[model samples]
Target: MTDATALVQHLNSDFSAGHDAVPARVNGTASPAIEQALAHPDLAEPIAAALAYAVVRARGAVRVAELGTCPADRVRPLRRAVERIATERAKAEAVCGPLRRPAQRASHRLGRSLKQTPARAVLPAAHRQTLVTACAELGLHADAFSVPNQRNGAWAQSRGLFGSVPSEAVRELAARDDTEFVAALLHDARMAEDERLGHHLIVERWNRLSATALAWGPYAIANAERRAVSRPLHARRDVLDALEDAYEDLAVLTCRAGEAKYRAFRLTCQVRELTVTGKRASVAAAAHRRAHELLQVSHPEELAEIAEAVRAHQVDCPFRADGCPDCQRVVLKGLSGQCQEAPGSRPEPTSPPQPTDASGPGVTYASFGAEERYAVLNDIPGGARVVVSDAAIGEDSALCGYGWAAEDGTTGHGDSMASTSGEAEIIGVCAAALTALTTHANDEFLVLCDSRQAVDAVQEVEEHGDVTRAQEAVLFPEAGELLTRLLPYAHRITVRWLKGHIGHDLNEAAEALAGLALRQARGRIAERTAHRARARTTSRIATQYLPRRSMPHAA
Candidate 1:
């Protein structure tokens, strides 16, 4: 059957059940108002259609709640359905004018009944302002024209009241379309009035408007504007002048609205970018290391072939023209400078490997059932007995790094582009575990980690019974890879959580190593940035001052 036919049948079934009957009687019967509205031949189809849409929408909302999380792809279609119904309602209203009293009463009763349904349950008052702001932006109000006019008119009247009484800076601010700035100004004015503070006092303590207070400005402005209308003209003028003067000073303190948060977000993106660049550099360094190892043993003819392969390998280094650090290191080892071409390739490289077991050396299998065999593996390898891992992020540089220390005096540290300290911690633990497992595959390992989250994640993975199922249960890429690699050695490896920073020698050593790694990464990034700047400056100077040769006449 067609969707419309099915919807109508569903609506009929609901109505026949007396689910929304007036007075909610036990016997099944339609409400008098509903019956009257449906009795009219002209209104019957539209009423049926509207009721059907409401039922379907309500059912969909229930299904969404049951599913716990809605897919992003489904959101657009649901929004379109809402929009279509709203458009149809608008068209009907335009043709019929305001809904008739009978139809209106029926709608009101239907709305009251729907409020009892799970789909129409009330949201918290804390989110009311947010919902209203979103509704304003989406133009979803019943009286869209009047609501916008009321908001704009309130601000315009307040601005006009100030006249030429305020400074040029204040007037400039008033003219801009920054709602947050205007809201903050109005909020400050209201606060000053409450404290009975003068305009000069407000200007003197302009910085007292904390970020937390600024956050509330958008929600407070509507009430401030409404209250302003009830005050005398003289009082309103005074508040506006105070708002203007305070803003004049506030503008000096902060050049933009939410400047602190914006700067922080921008800095985070920069750090993430640098971290990504550093990761690429690390990969290039590894490839160069491999080439050097091959060069030492290969025949003279193989040297040229190896160099050719090295030149063909791609690297994403910003300082390629000046010479990538990795390529420079290779050049010092007597390789031809043409090897630099590898780092200078124009095409994009494949994505760097994620922190996973597969990225490390392959695991060697040994029978875990025999204790003697495990002891032989440990005795022969002479690997560390205990390994402690820690992660740290630079306060000034914003670079993330991880370090691990072993009882056998083996130590390792590396930098990552992790956006958060927590992620870095997990990465550090994984790196430490992967190293230990690969170096002594048959040996028992006690991996000490400070991060509770990483330990819990490992525990959760271990409890899942099936290795494949456990791997699938983990949602994070790094954590999943770590689990996949570590689970294979679960019989011999143990991950334990330890408290951090109470002078635990191994943990402290790991922390120091992580900090050292962060500092090193920071220095490398700064050097790379300076190299890029110098290159750009040189190129610009050449373009501007270097004389262009005249082309031959086209005879």
Candidate 2:
């Protein structure tokens, strides 16, 4: 008869004996127990026997389906954990390889000179994307790298990576549930690309595979499921490369942001010197050095990227600009500086909301763009406008007991503006005498410290009323002694401490006067220039409250 009759006959024969002697398989081979004993190897015989006895396992189809949903749901996280790692890997690989033709060409030339190497797993989303990418370009398989771990009974992760559903998985899931196809198709259109893939394929795969594993008992399922859920070795490596590339944009952007901020901060501190010296060379040098440090930290994984890309001959620039040798392109270089053309000849195209790496340190799309980053740097060192008045500089002895009021000389001395000079009266002199000039200057007046250490030494000298080795040569000026006598009159004198650049009209006036006096002291007798200085300082008063970079554009 047919195989069915034979299987029937065997089961009937065994059942005829007793339930305890149930046939392990429907087929008339060895009894399940005998086979389990003879197979010697563990579990193989049992799983084989259990499935073979499924005829005995036959149950209402409805019941089986109901049970299916439970186990399958349990295994969902494990599968998802695997796929998430894959998507990021792919993005990183795309960036590192041939984003531009010239880069591609260079990669190709370099590849020829080098031996093939293995690829490593990379994530464009992580800190080491560049390194991960370079390994990918060199035929190295970066994505193959994964260290999986379980969390909770239901969830699992690989590489601290999330689980994702790819497009193929979605198709598989949809095909299995054709009854829901129309609804899913409609939903797919409204979903994001990754989310669409996730709902159909990723969720479906997880539901199916995990349920399958759980049905066989979670223990057995877990043991065998490793292979079923694993990323294909080649695909894994490819994904890792993509992941690394994802962060390339970020890596470059972060370095750029950091370097920009560092330079901006440095500039704000030394604007006076920088403007006067016209030495922008140090800015570039510092930028380059800072960029390098950032590369070391943010792109540790990308150290060999250039060399690897080169040796693999992966570089291909469509612009044909790659062919222009450095010396050959001197005329061209004048027009385009730096690489004759970008590593790729991508014509600069204006695109809405231009895409940028979401990876850099201070690179926020909303508030932390290049401009804002510079502002933060500028804030690092404070800038202020102040009215500094020294009594000796006034016109008392015409030489010694003099005070220079900012803009005291705006009109005469021919309309050439200069600081006002005045002789201090005895009362003013009494307040200044026996005083620690530096000490009183700082304590009585808040100095926004151009340097943190100027007055302490000066202040300490007179606190003990003792002159030091340095002070022995010059006696404390009478003006300082007078200040010591009448410091209590500070409430009367009204020495106001103003923040730098704030719109305090007096501060602006004082600063303007100071500038005018300095110019005058240098023997410049230009009246128009002095008047203009006051206007400039006044104009900037409004900008004092805005961040440094914004100062130029503040209302």
Candidate 3:
């Protein structure tokens, strides 16, 4: 049998069993037993086995369609197969978790192989003729030649990394006609060549354009579902060498991206210091030590370039380049200076403590034994204050709350009925700092917190300027979003460490608020859980006791 016929036969045979088990529907409705079994892995074996067969059928169709040797009419059956598989996977996600990734992988393999195929096999007649004529004029063989295979492959790889073509790029392509699509792609190809850039550099520029026709848009040649190519891995030596090259490229790029991000964040801190305080920011000896440890760099010289850039910006004073040349000279001279302080020796509170909100009726704050004096440096300028914040989680990992107290007797706290302690900790600190920053935008603020993880998360945001990095590190996701919102006001913010329950006044007060918040949150959670249980009991009783026709309608 031919490729299409063989694919149809495989799909038919594989899915022949349980033909009536799931009705063909796009509504994503399914039987409760099947749904429950799919979601719960202990009950997944039966459904997983059934899905394995469907996966095989769908993947095979995609593969044969991609090979380019198949007839054009075969596209119809292949499209239908893809749709059916997608529908099935959509309905199964209640149990299957994520099946689309496997389907996407199959498509990627197809797109990557298309580049090595002849243009006549991959492109339609008009476009193929255009390419053929152009090739003849350029003194290249029409029938046997590939179309810029290296850049095309690189674009394909970038698409695979990004997962899909961006929507804006797709919308731009939608405005263009099919012939223009090919013309625009060729135009970009010529531009890439004229620049004399390597394949990866050209591809990176194309990817960054976001509006370029060569972008993997719906009608673009580099479309992940259409024309593309990859080298065959059957040649062991070539494949191995290619793998090594790719690994090296990826590793170098990852390192550079991280290093650049770190340097950018540090420079931002320095700029904030100069702009806000009219003097250099004091660096904590330990904070720098921690940063170096995380970066895994032995020499400080790796950081010197970005540090110099920050100093240059301060000196050049682009915002006031001509008017304050003398001011710039003084600032540049001071940029080389640092006032290092020993760890945990932050400035002491200048203002007296305000009384705690002890009369709140719902929950009582937990008091840590007796208040004791902790040594704090008295070096901070008159008005600057540290906000000591902390998060508390209940035993069942359900209830969470965070609280903060500024050295000037300004205190605030918030609570949530759900989340882990780590999540709660970061949220508490970030949420507290966000409120404080909004209230005091012009004042310098330091966030003192007890959770090392939470402090590190804030540090990550400071060093990388990516709050979502915390969520990517599997810290709290909500905390990441909150931190992202706080970025605009970051110039005035600093986060530092505080030892928990050590009898420092603001730290103790913040702890009390955190504990109280946790208590209140747990009570709220308990009420909700009880309410849900009661509702479920009522539902079961009504279902079992009442006649089907007489059962009360659900609101």
Weakest 10 consecutive residues, lDDT, candidate 2? Answer: 409-418
Model 2 scores what on Cα lDDT? Answer: 0.30
TM-score of every candidate relative to the true structure: 0.27, 0.18, 0.29
How big is the positional error of residue 86 in model 2, measured in Å on the Cα after superposition? 57
lDDT rank order = 3, 1, 2
Best by lDDT: 3
Error of 1 at 384 (Å): 9.3
What's the lDDT for residue 252 in model 1?
A: 22
lDDT of 2 by residue, 1-555 (tens): 865444444433332332223232223455654443423322222222233222212211211222223365544543443244334334433433333333324322221112111111121233235434544544434532211121111121222122443356544544655335423432332232224322312342332232122221212212222222234333344433332332222222222222233233222223222211234334323332343344456655452453344333434433334432322222222224322232224667876763222233453334545322212122221332112222222110012221111111111111111111221222122222212232234323222111112123223333444434213222224334443444443332322221235333433344445445434332233557766765565444434433332322211
Better of 2 and 3 by lDDT: 3
- Ordered by TM-score, highest first, the candidates read 3, 1, 2
What is the C-alpha RMSD, rounded to one decimal, of candidate 1? 33.4
Local distance difference test values of all predictions, in order: 0.43, 0.30, 0.44
Off by over 4 Å in 3: 1-382, 417-419, 472-476, 524-555
User: Which 10 consecutive positions of candidate 1 have the poorest summed lDDT?
Assistant: 111-120
